[model samples]
Target: MAATVAQPTHMTRAKHWNEEVENAYRFQLAGWRDQVEYTGHKGEVTTWPNGLIKKLMRKSDECWYYFNKTRECADKDINKCKLYTY
Candidate 1:
């Protein structure tokens, strides 16, 4: 006779921050920095450095996790924003 093995029947889901929450955290930190706007012959333009985004993401473990997850999701989906590659 063959021995019988027990199989697990229940599974639990892990909790994670959604894109909206992640974006909210990013935008909150981004708002703290002053944006530099320039008006050249072409037209008005605005830009910010990636350093600011990195700094904000590193502020706390939660922030970093959300940022990292965002990047990972973005890698698979083209619709997601690719803010920090690292």
Candidate 2:
């Protein structure tokens, strides 16, 4: 039997820049709702030594989206990213 994948039950637009927002920004930028959905599609994710995501392969094109250890979401993008809660 195939394993079941986890998914988000709730989502909301991010209002500030924090750890959670940073994670959501990366997943959303790669065209997903959050890590749960990303992992559901990609299997697993890569992360940096600091525990931040290192990169993500976009499902639509299979291209990679690399992330810095620091924040990547700009002031303009903060409001555009949707944070998910399960």
Where is model 1 more than 4 Å wrong at Cα? Answer: 1-16, 32-86
- For each candidate, C-alpha RMSD in Å? 20.9, 2.1
- Model 2, residue 50: C-alpha shift (Å): 2.0
TM-score (all chains, Cα) for each model: 0.21, 0.84
**Tens-digit lDDT string for candidate 1 (1-86):** 22332333442321344543344344334332111110111122222343222333322332332233223223223333222211
Q: Pick the candidate with the highest lDDT.
A: 2
Predicted structure 1: lDDT = 0.29
